[model samples]
Target: MSIAAIPTIKLELALQSPWMANQVAITRNNRLFLGLPRYSAEFSTPSLARQAADGSLQPFPGNSWNTWKPGDDGREAFVYLNSVHVFNDETVWCVDQGSLSAGVFGEQYSKPAPGAQKIVQLDAKNGAILRILRFDDHILPPGAQLNDLRFHGSLMYVSDSGLGGIIVHDLENGKTIRRLSGLSVVKASDKAPPAMLAHVKGGTTFHPPNSDMIEITADGKWLYWAAPTGPLYRVETRILRDMTRSDAEVASQVEAVYDNNFSGGCAMDSEGNVYFSETVTHNITVWSPTGKTAVLVSDPRLVRPDGSFISQDRKLYIPVKQPVNTVTANGKSEQRFNIYSINLPRHLDGIDLGRAITGV
Candidate 1:
């Protein structure tokens, strides 16, 4: 379907409810999950929220999971949500980094408690937390800034953007290892748009995170990612999944793939096409699996599009926010703080492709 085919009236209604969200996801049944990271929120907010087709928002999983206060024990609640995912259509995985910025460590952002900095995995049907995956200081470090994640078989790959590394965790064996930390590719290249570089408060801040967003191909062969200020890179999933591989072995498999200039959030379709939200250009572009690039959508309302999701119906849902608009524009981004979506081609949604396709 063409982008213009999206109803004008519905798009207008979607624009009416403006909320700054870091990420957005859609379930097989069409449920919308919004990741509203708390560290940057100016008002009281739900770190993870669920929005219905009628435009109502509610604390996802439950209110208890979203009501953690400053001094409260955060083990049962969310500290700061950087990314949220609907795993295999029946589960939700919420990535809580436990801090204001992922790169600044040893601050109070370690989730308010020892085990608080973890992934909250819950059953989508009952809203019951099925399990929690905790990363100790040795594995996660304090305020390691777990940015985003991709699942492969019995393993999961998490981006430690804060400290510069990709954490490979084994769900079945419970072994976690941080790889590619020594590679400059996993760290911020300090190549953010020169226009935003002059901003007094922006991406150039001391704690610039590395290896920010993550994506897994449809065949689970390659994993692509980069810092928010980026040049997309990829590595073999087999190397990351093999828990026995040494750090050097895994690092050797890394490859600099696409030159995805400073981008916000991204998502991959089952056909291996990746849709990147161009933060600097304020546009949406797609990189085909075969290494070609093209602009998919362009709009003034797409200011700083962050983490996005491609629905089973092939609609790319995006959340727009402009954290540095104070220097970028007067109030362009603030006015359009909305969850916008563009209709895509017949490509399948990655996460909703099939059950255990990676041989869980």
Candidate 2:
């Protein structure tokens, strides 16, 4: 069933610190989790936080977890929290990209500190740190920015936006493998023009350097990904899990799924419908299982929808960060950040695809 028009409802407003919200994760019980990355000097908020009933930003777990000093270990504190993923098992996984800022305005943006790049798993109920996984320098280089991630069974696939490629991690053995490094599909398109937002004074370029958005099918069979300025592509998870396959062989298995404009984030529902936030167009586009693309929602206020979350109740939550506008405004971002939610149709609701298929 194709949705003709979806109405967006304003969920929350970030009046305290505008233009700092990045990602939103809603638990099964309807708890909201927000991630704030320290992108500019204007915003000095917690890297990872949760929204209280009164709409206040409380540091997740504790204040020490969000505090970062010069000599602190990046593994212990939240250096630069990028994305947060809450799974069906009631565990929250936070992705620390390590980079201080996106380096959009200038090269002086801070770089990733030691022990900064890692994934932390937390208990969703009480926000307790369950486990932490750090990648080696060889697998995940110092300059590599670990972007979004998706899970299929015991394996987790992470996108390296700074360094073009995908890093596969084994949850059981803690081994990692990097695939399709420097590949054209995984890297941002040089031919594609820069993305411009309407609210910003001057348009800012959005060359993500590598793949930044990713999504897995409900059945856990296919993994789809794309660079911020490149076309969509997907490959079978079986091939990605096959350790015997060579990089060339794995690259051959990747198939171009869709040719789209520059986008910020992408997600997939249980019904096999894919959603993409087209920052240049200021709209969210949906691609159905039968290979049809349609605009789900379009609004001028959606200035760079960075990360999206679909709750079990079929509500799509999107955090409007407006990164381009913030950078173009020279860190004096006047626009207010907000989290919007739109109820999706029953046919488009998200399910535990991994659990449904594997019966875990």
**TM-scores vs. true structure, each candidate:** 0.83, 0.84
User: lDDT tens string, model 1, 1-360?
Assistant: 112211221222133223458887767786777788764434566787777557787677676888876767777888888888875645778888755532333345444367677888877666788888887777776546688888867678899887778888888888888777647878888777666555443233443468898887766788888887777888887787676987678877878777776777888776667778888776676776566666666676677778888766766777777532322355444332577766664432221222212212
Superposition TM-score, candidate 1 onto the true structure:
0.83
Stretches of candidate 2 above 4 Å error? 1-19, 69-72, 102-109, 195-206, 323-335, 347-360
Worst 10 residues of 2 by lDDT: 351-360
Alpha carbon lDDT of each predicted model: 0.69, 0.72
lDDT of 1: 0.69
Cα displacement (angstroms), candidate 1, residue 44, comes to 1.1
Tens digits of per-residue lDDT for model 2, 42-94: 55567777767787767787758887744467768887788888877768899
TM-score of predicted structure 2: 0.84
Checking candidate 1 for backbone clashes, the offending pairs are 98-109
Model 1: worst 10 consecutive residues (lDDT sum) = 350-359
Q: How far is candidate 2 from the true structure (C-alpha RMSD, Å)?
A: 5.3
